[model samples]
Each structure stands twice: as C-alpha cells, then as structure tokens.
Target: MTTEDERMARFARTPAGQRGYDAAEVDAFCERIAAAFQGSTMLTAAQIREHEFAAAAFGHHGYDRDQVDDYLDRACVDLEYARRGDSPHPGPERLSPRDVQRLRFSAPPPGRDGYAAAEVDTFLDVVAATLAHAGPTGLSSQDARAIDFCPAEPGGPSYYADEVDAFLDVVVRTLTEQEQKHTAS
Candidate 1:
C-alpha cells in the first residue's frame, strides 16, 4: 500500500463495513494530494480547497466523510503554507474591516427581532482590528453568544441572527488561532 493509502487506513472504518465514501474515489484524491506534496502534480492550493468529491455509497466499504474532509483541509493548508514558505507559527491572516463588512447576510423582515445590525457591524469592526492586532478585546464564542440584539424599528430590517452567529464562529476561530500561534512563539 502507498503512504497515502496507509494514512487513509488510520481513520475509523464503518461499523461492520457498511456504506462509506468510495474507496476508488478516495484513493484517486489521495493520489492527487500525494503527487502535489511530492512535486509531481501542479495541484494549486485553491484547487485543493475548491475540489469536490463524489459520494461513495455501495455494497463495498468506503471511508468516513468527516475524516476525509478533515484530512483534506489539513492537507490543503499544509500545501498553502508550504508554497508560501510559511511556518503557520507567528503570522495570522489579517482580516480587514472591509472584509467583515462584505460578509453577506439576508436581512430580517421588519417587526421581528434580529441580530441588531448596527451592533454586529460594530463588533465586526472591533474583530477586524483585533485580528490585525490593533484591539484589546479577546473575543470568544461565548462572548459572541452573550451579545444581545434589540428589536428593529417598524419596517426596519436587521441582520439575520444565525448568519451573524456563524460569522462569529469564524472570527473566534481566527482569533484563537492567532493567539495560539503567538503564545507558542
């Protein structure tokens, strides 16, 4: 078995060998990643990130989807960092205020309680600065969840709460990753 094949084997198999991701599909994808890592293929990091996989469900056993996704993410990140000669230790991807503002969401209808759009915008502004190392707030998921939004004025729209919450999760992940890297150094 190849090294990639061996790595794939490390993941937990389906119970009693039931339906899972197709073995051939998994093998081909792994081969591509292996080739990229070994300088045999020109698979760009963006391609790695955007690549889609076919669902493998049949009488034969296959790999778990979650495990495959996790590994693929790690592999893509590895390739990106490798290409940039990055150590993923000291530097964090600086998210700009504009980037935060550009996060698209469907506004809630009038007369309904939504994530106060203004409050979320202000918080995102702060998050942008924090990510850029220009702010003091160590925002966490809990802190984000604690934030309350007021009802919108009559016929006024507010940001969707679930979308805002999902964005906050991304923010927290970015902040914690930066902090951990800094601390490790």
Candidate 2:
C-alpha cells in the first residue's frame, strides 16, 4: 500500500465504551478514498465533505470521530487538486471547506465599527459551499470580490472588518487560482 493508503487506514479507534464512527463504514469509505487516489474511482471533494458514517458503541468500538473528520478534510483538498489535473498534493495556500468551516473572527471591541455578524457568517457559509462544490455554476472569485456585508448597527454584534477582509482575500485568491488551473488545462 502507498503512504496515502496507510494514512487512510491509520485512524485510531474509539475506546471500549465510547461511541464513535462505525468501523465498518469508515473502513469501507477509506477503501473508496484509496481507490480515488489511485485513479480507479471518481469521488469529488464535496462528496467527501458530505459523507456520513454510522455510529458504534461498546465492544464494537469504532474509529475516532475527530480523526476521521480531520483526515477526510485533508483528503478532500488533495482530491480537489487532483481533479483539476494539478499536483495531487494540495499546497498550503489552498483552502478546504473545512478550513472555512473552522474559521473564527473576533468581534469588534466596543464602539468600533465592523461588519454585521449575521451577514458575514452567512457570506462565509456561501464561500464554504463554493469551495466544497466549485464549478462554473458556483460562486467565483469575482463574486467574492463583489460581496459587501452591511455594517453592524451601533452596539450590535460584529466581526472585525480587517479580519473579515483578510479572510475574503484568501478566499478570492484560492478561487482565482483554481480557475486558472482549470483554464490552463
């Protein structure tokens, strides 16, 4: 087996009494992931992101849930680059939907102006969806550049403008790079 194959199979199982992802289901999924890596199957990043596994408990202890999720998150990024005919190794600059999902920004200090919390969060959800299923029909870098959230009303919850803009820049660059690669091919 290749290094990637070993990696896929290396997820630790949950302890004896704890609930975790079903071992059988996770193992089967890993086999599919390995097949995809070997170019024997077609599996998109979105599919990886959306996959669900049954839960296991007691003597049937399953794989650690966090480990499986984290590994799958990385696999989705690598698979996305592979699908684009780019190097199979996703560069550090690439942003997976998981990355976007985990992003958190500090709320602005009292009396400071910032983007509306709900609006920014909503936009981020769209951005994550775009990354998960990017295509001609999905949101593009241009769309990201054009997004303008409403400013938070005074005393209302808000995200720091600088942080939001920085993250948006990263999103734009990631989308633009993906588009470039697709066009080049």
Candidate 3:
C-alpha cells in the first residue's frame, strides 16, 4: 500500500491563472488536508467538503476552481468514509457528490400541474427563517440539520437545490451534535 506521504506527494499543484481561485488559499487548505491525513490535524470532512476560497481575478493564471473542487470532493469523500469506519455510531452517511452541484429539480409529471407557487415559497421562507433563528419559533439547531426537502415543483420560483442542501447539511450537523450531547447527558 502506498504511504500517506507518497499519496499526497502526487497531488497536482494548480497552475496560476486569472479568474481562478486564489492559489495561496488553495495551497494552504491542501496543506491542512494533508496534515489531517498524516494524523497531525483534526479537520473534519464537512470542513473539507465545504471549503471555499475567493476567486483569483487578478493575474495571468491561478489554480483551477473546477479541478480543485473536484479533487476536494474526492478527498472529502475518502476522509469521511475513513472516519466513519472508525466511529461507533451506526448508519453514518456521507453526502452524495451530486448534492453539491447546481441541479435543476425535475418538473411536474406529464399532465399534473406544479405545486402552488405561493405555498411552496411560503414553506421555503419558513424553513429559511427557522434555520436563521429569525422568528420567535424556529427549528431547533438539530431539526435544522436533520431537515431534508425534496426539489420544489419545477415551475414557478423554484429554489436552488444545491444551496438548500448545503445549508441544511450544516443545520443537520449542528442539530445532531446537540442531540448527541442531550443523549449523553
């Protein structure tokens, strides 16, 4: 089996270019990831999966965002599964790769009409408000994290699935941790 050092040494460094992500930031993040793999850092899979760097619109060449993001996705998945295997918790699941994409949810079936735009929007608004802890009543941090939504009716004012999935994953993580604490206590 190839050693961790060997595996990481093969990482392709991104080229500097314009309109790409900041090379320094990307490199820094990769270093952290490598450290995690070497058992010297405590970074989590979610952190890796959600990592973002500002775009580099300044110079001639920069690290490619598509390549970086794809690589990160693979790394995050590998790390998540590895960690999950070590956890005592049952049924641990990782997010699907498609979950991060800007996907267009399918529309209503053949003859069926779309959901009522007003009601759908209202529901989404409520969810957003609750997640943001805006109103007097909202989803508990755990509920926010655990909550999942199907794609909105593919007609009027549909929300982006990728955005909602990402937000809800964060929420679920928060809520699940709280639940674990409560259970332990």
- Candidate maximizing lDDT: 2
Q: Estimate, for each residue in 62-171, the C-alpha lDDT of model 3 and write its tens digit.
A: 67666776556555544544454532212113322232231222234444444443444454455555434433355565555445444445555544343334444443
Query: Considering lDDT, where higher is better, how would the candidates rank from best to worst?
Result: 2, 1, 3
lDDT (Cα, 0-100) at 154 in candidate 3: 51
Question: TM-score: which candidate is best?
Answer: 2
CA lDDT, every prediction? Answer: 0.58, 0.74, 0.50
Q: Candidate 3 at 112: error in angstroms?
A: 30
What TM-score fits each model?
A: 0.46, 0.50, 0.41
For TM-score, candidate 1 versus 3, the one ahead is 1
User: Each model's RMSD to truth, in Å?
Assistant: 9.6, 14.2, 16.6
Write model 1 residue lDDT over 31-71, tens digit each, in one string.
Answer: 78777766677876456545776655656556776777656
Return the TM-score for candidate 1, rounded to 2 decimals: 0.46
Q: What stretches of model 3 exceed 4 Å from their correct place?
A: 1-18, 86-185
Quick one: ranking by TM-score, best first? 2, 1, 3
Alpha carbon deviation, residue 44, candidate 1 (Å): 1.6
Which 10-residue window in model 2 sums to the lowest lDDT? 1-10
